[model samples]
Target: MNHNVILTCAVTGAGDTTAKSPHVPVTPKQIADDCIAAARAGASVAHIHVRDPETGTISHSVEHFREVMQRVREADVDIVMNITAGGGGDWIPDAADPTRGGPGSDIQTPRQRHEPVGELLPELCTLDCGSLNFGDMVYVNPADWLREHARLVQAAGVKPELECFDLGHVWFARQLQQEGLIDGDPLYQLCLGIPWGAEADTETLLAMRNRLPHDAHWAAFGIGRHQMPMAAQAVLLGGHARVGLEDNLYLEKGVLATNAQLVEKAASLFENLGARVMTPAETRAHLALRDPNTGHVVEKAIETTAGGAA
Candidate 1:
């Protein structure tokens, strides 16, 4: 029943989805352009992930990140940038030798994973709370690693968007809050519908939401076909919504869609449900997020029913 909501468009994810849809952005300019387009289409934040332009494979290069950041920053549109700090955790053991990593294994130290976020200084960064069976491979984010990642985000003075893929992750996120590792008011993203993780259904979403901190500002999203439905559900359950090419690549059955199209559809749903999509400035004040580039608080108090709901 929350009337005010923040819509985030995840431009591109670190998945093998580029070939599946022609609309999926791969190059730095494409990613940045989509970020701007999504903002114009009503998304307040852009959750970004870079990829190798030539191969369309996920990349962690600071050079790629810099190009994308520079384009988005120099753009005239105002969009809150949220960089992923959850990379370098993909581990696939080799079939021939279980002791060695397979072709898809992409693991890095905690600092290596946080390097881009640390150097780029985006307004928000993600911290995956726990390890989970991510489809055929296992995505590892052990307790120790998570603790260290949280500390790194805290030290950067950027908001950590605690990404909880399961109910246990929600519990661990609360633990991080208790341990004082997460700074400022807790900001969480209830990541649903990933393989072997939480299901993308009302029962699961409500169960996870019930366990969140009472005052936490949170958003939720579902992958693939459940994307728009879960976004509408999030609004009904008093939370913000996220949509983009990252989680879904279609406007309808057999229809390819761009990031802006996805955000526009989500915004339509929000308005139809009696909720107004929040702008970047409003989200900044509502979440008390900092300016990543300038390293200063970006809050502007305004009078509205949804001003401080989260």
Candidate 2:
């Protein structure tokens, strides 16, 4: 079992969970406040997704991202911001015409999906590896578009959190690595327990873990009741943990949870599991991530100095 772990809080996802839970943040200020709260509660990173303040629907506006980033950066606590570039890929076919997009179909060019990440320059952002049957709709992420998106993230000096929902997605992520599109030690988020994707069970998690590159920094999360259990499993298997309203909305059976409460629970659970939950600064050093706010290497520059001294 791994003795050290990094806990990431997926603050707010693009899903329609806002109406279900009052704790889910909607406005830019609310989202930024939740990020700070999660960091103070012991989250090493905040995986963020923005929504329209009025409609509570998903949005890809760069200005919205800017406001959220500004609020987080000016806060006293420090945390790595990880935006979602996986929006604008939903495809719900029309009932009458399969060729025409349906009510929920929201598809955009690779550049359109990447506007926020390109403009805001967060330290980390997610790249959904491939398409999947996301419930009633299809999450459309083609290989060529992914290649183009990877190039955009690479050019912007932002590291991507490779989000794989299945074994095939993992294969494609490895392909991206082979094609020299991903930079440095890639960070992988093995997303489990989504419909028609990978199941939330030990056998499947183990299989996905075994398929990952030996050098990759990875984490796994399960939705609903499987959240905490899978997080504990991830730590035991030498990987990090992710927990929050984005994946699960409960502190217990029939009990709603805030983002901070879930992160706090993860921190406590990981500590008792004989694993040390790493801080944000420690996590950056461990992954050799650069400081997005200052444009400095978090650890590699120090390593280079030490090497020269030797």
Candidate 3:
């Protein structure tokens, strides 16, 4: 288990949850502000997904992404930006014609899915490893498309976080690593408790953790009521943890939560476990990331004096 633990806060997801909870940030400004605040609350990274402001639905517009990026850049926070390339894959099959896509289906080509990452060049971007029945609609990402997406991310110099919803997805992620499409030590985000995905329990988490590459930098997250418990489990199992309104909206039973609140809760869990929460600077060093803004290979440099022992 890696002693150092990194916490990520998903600021605003591309989910239709504006009406479900008031804490879900709607506009770009709100999302950016929430991300900055989450950083202050001890989140080293912030996963972002933009939404349509008026309709309060998910959107993949570059303009929306630009707005969020600009605001975060202008702020004094030092959080790592991780944009989503998992959009444009949701496919709702047509009832009348099984072969055709239904109204909510958002099937897009690999290039289309990665346009935002290419344009923005964020420090990290998510790459869902394979297709799965995401609720009623199937989140489609054929192997060819996934390979293309990974190549684009690697070429752009952005680290790809392989998001695995199930054990089979983990196998595919490993396959990608073996194929050399993903460079450096890979990062995995185990998404648990989502309907039709891996369940949120100790046994399931351990099995998935066991299958991961020994050197893989990984994080796990659970949805709704399992959020905090899964965070603690990840920390105990020597892995990083993620929490935000995107996966869980409730702080407690019948209580709505903000992004900041979720991050704070995770921080407390880290404290209880006797593990220190890493800052963005510390996380950057741990991951050995190059600066996205400057193309500099940033490493933690050791300080030495002229004399060994004054």
State residue 140's C-alpha deviation in candidate 2, in Å.
Answer: 0.2
Q: Candidate order by TM-score, highest to lowest?
A: 1, 2, 3
- Tell me the TM-score of each prediction against the true structure: 0.96, 0.96, 0.95
Give the higher-lDDT candidate: 1 or 3.
1
Lowest summed lDDT over 10 consecutive residues: which window, candidate 3?
A: 301-310
lDDT of 2 by residue, 184-205 (tens): 8878889999998999999998
lDDT of 1 at 133: 99
Candidate 3 lDDT, tens digit per residue, 69-138?
8899889888888999999998887989979988988877889889999999888899999988887778
RMSD of each: 2.3, 4.3, 5.7
lDDT of each: 0.88, 0.89, 0.85
lDDT of 1 at 221: 97
Give per-residue lDDT, candidate 2, residue 96.
98
